[model samples]
Every structure is written in C-alpha cells, then in structure tokens.
Target: MFLIVKSLMLVLMILMVLILVLNLCSMKTFYDKEKNSPFECGFDPKSNSRTPFSLQFFLIAIIFLIFDVEIALLLPIIKTYNMDNITLIITSNFFIIILLLGLIHEWNQGALNWLK
Candidate 1:
C-alpha cells in the first residue's frame, strides 16, 4: 500500500511537470490588434471612449434588476410555505400585491417600453 501511494504521487508530479512544460512550449508570443482591443459594448473602444450611453437601456436594466431581486425575495417564502401559518401567507400575499402594483406603476409610466 505504501509503495502504491508513493508511485501515484510520483506519477502525478511527473504529469504536472509535463503539462507545465507543454503549456510553456506552446505559449504564443505574437501580438494581435483585434484580440488585444477592449470589449466593444456600444461604441469603439479603440477610438473615443466618451460615447454617450443610452439612458433608456439603463432604465430597462434597473427595472429588470428590481424584478430579479423581487423574485429572489419571493422564492424563500415558497420553501417555507405552510397552510397553518395564516399570517405568513397574508404577508407574502401582501408582498406580491405590492410588487404587482409597482410593476403596474412602471407600466403606466411607459418605463417598460423598449422602443420610443
């Protein structure tokens, strides 16, 4: 058993060294114009970085995050659900109702609209 364990450790060390050597041997030294450029979100990163951000997209993202957190908050109530617990049910229901009202308010305000 001792010999087998020692052999396994030796094999693992050899394999690790082999992998490191192979990776270093295959490393690319070539520089690339496109590959090195920053991520192009809405405007060119290589050019002017002072491009105007879309506020409409930002508003939609904020609304999405609000709903996302609302779902996160609501999920725990599902796991703790008990018909005998009347107040918990009432409280969760009230929470859902409030979320729905907020959603409706956002909808009425046209904040949910994607295209102007």
Candidate 2:
C-alpha cells in the first residue's frame, strides 16, 4: 500500500510540474475583434456567424429522442415475451406504464404541439 501511494504521489507531482511548466512557457494573447471575427475568403463577413436557435425545436427533439430510446428498450421485452417469467412481465408492464405517464405529461405540457 505504501509503495502504491508513493508511486501515485510521484506521478501526480510530475503531472503538476509539467502543467506548471507548460503554462509558464505558453504565450498569452489579448483578445482582438478582427482576429475573432469569421473570415470568408480573406474578406470581411457580410453577416454575423452566430444565429439565434429556437428552443422549442430543441425541446421537441429531446423529447423525441427520449421516446425513441424507450422504444428501443421495449423491443427486447417483445423478444422475451414467450419466456413465461412473471417477474419479467411485471417489470416490463411497470416500465411501459412509466413511459406512458411521461408521454401523457409531455402531451399535457404542449410539447407535442408544433403550431405553438
């Protein structure tokens, strides 16, 4: 245990010294607008590169992904349906209930409405 601890300490100390040396040797630069701006064919950009994104689209996509993954997880339950295991059936039913509840909650929250 002592040898293991000593080796770990040596490795950590080496890493810390290397980090400190790299930081001390690096060149620091001040921010400049021209340097940061998007370059297009060595000419000034006509418009801003960054644009505002719609949060609604992101939320809907996330919800879709969640349900999609749940569907994938449910596929295996169908394959195991003939196993005649009560515990497995009960657990899968509970999982389906939870997913259904989540879907209902999202629907109530208007996440499924695209026209909003």
Candidate 3:
C-alpha cells in the first residue's frame, strides 16, 4: 500500500508539472480582424453570411432520420425469428406497433406535409 501511494503521488506531481509547463508555453497575444472574417477573393462580401433555413425541410429530415433508425432496429428482428422464444416475437411486434403509432401521430399533425 505504501509503494502504491508513493507511485500515485509521483504520477500526480508529474502531471501537474506537465500541465503548468504547457500553460506557460502556449499563449496568443495578437488577433487580426481581416484574418477572422469570411474571405470573398479580397472583395467585401455583398450579403450577410448567415441565412434563414427552412423549418419544414428540417422537420422532414428529422422524420426521415427517425424512420431510418427504426428500420435498422427492425432489421435485427429477422435474425431473431428463428429462435424459439415467443416473448421475443411479441416484443418485436409491440415495437413495430409503437413505430406505426408514432408515424400515424406525425401524419395527423401534418408534419409530413411538404406542400404547405
């Protein structure tokens, strides 16, 4: 126990010395304005860099991601079908039902509407 404690204290001291040396060596004293701004071939930008995004496209992408992940999860059930477990089958079915219900809810809420 005494040897372990001594080794740990040595490691801690070495780490502290390393951190202090790094902190003292790395310093940034200067900042340039032109270096930070977005470049447009040496010409001043004509428009704002930030633009508003479409919320409808964002929602559609999110829904697509959710369904994609659920499809991946459902694919494993095909491998488990050969097993002799009734509970596994029931659980997989229940998961599918939940996914369908979520889809129905999203549909009813008009989240799937792209035309509006």
Candidate 4:
C-alpha cells in the first residue's frame, strides 16, 4: 500500500509539472482569428456548413436500423434453438412467424423498394 501511494504521488507530481510547463509555454505564444475557427476539410474555409440533408437518407437509415435490430434479436434465438428438439422448434417457428409478419408490412409499405 505504501508503494502504491508513493507511485501515485510521483505520477501526480509529474503530471502537475508537465501541466505547469505547458501553461507557461502557451502564455508566451499568441493565437490568431483563424486558429480559433472550427477547422474545415483543409480547404479554404467556407461559411455554410449546416446545409439541409435529404429525407431519403434518413428513411433508408431508419429502415436499416429496424431490420438490423430484428436480425440481432433473431440470431440469439437461432443459436439457442435445436432443430432436432420439438419444443424449441415450435418456439423458433413462432419467432419466425412474427418476423415474417413484420416483413410483409414493410413490403406493403414499399419500404423494400430501392429504386423508388
């Protein structure tokens, strides 16, 4: 315990010295207007960074999240279920039925169409 405390104190003292040195050095330098501005793509900086995005991108992302979560839920059950066992087979089938229902709903809503 004494060794651990001593080591921690040594580390803290080193960090404090480093911070003091950095602060002293930073005070000697002067910062300009551009230095404070948010850096852009290394290009000559432009003004309009907050342009509106497309709705289609959001729609596709949301659809992907929905299906991805469904699959994530499915995979664990698939791992647990044994095809040769009857009770597990029926439970897995019920899960599949619910997943199929969700798929049919998405299909009817034209969410499955990529070209639209």
- What CA RMSD would you report for each candidate? 4.5, 9.5, 8.3, 7.0
Predictions in order: lDDT: 0.87, 0.85, 0.85, 0.78
Cα lDDT tens digits, model 3, 18-90, are: 9999988877334767666778744467675565667898899999999999989998986867766887778
Best by lDDT: 1
1-116, model 2: which lDDT tens digit per residue?
99999999999999999999998987854587776777775545776656556688889999989999998998798676676688777879899999999999999999888887
User: How does candidate 1 fare on TM-score?
Assistant: 0.68
Return the TM-score for candidate 4, rounded to 2 decimals: 0.51
lDDT of 4 by residue, 32-107 (tens): 6777766765544565656665566667788789878987987788577666677777887887898889889878
- For model 3, the superposed segments whose C-alpha errors exceed 4 Å read 1-47, 80-82
Q: How many residue pairs clash in each candidate?
A: 0, 0, 0, 0
Candidate 1, clashing residue pairs?
A: none
Give the runs in model 4 whose Cα sits over 4 Å from its true position: 1-4, 11-52, 78-84
Residue 45 lDDT in candidate 4: 54
Model 3, position 43, has a per-residue lDDT of 48
Error of 4 at 44 (Å): 14
Error of 3 at 14 (Å): 46
Extract clashing residue pairs from model 2.
none
TM-score of each: 0.68, 0.51, 0.53, 0.51
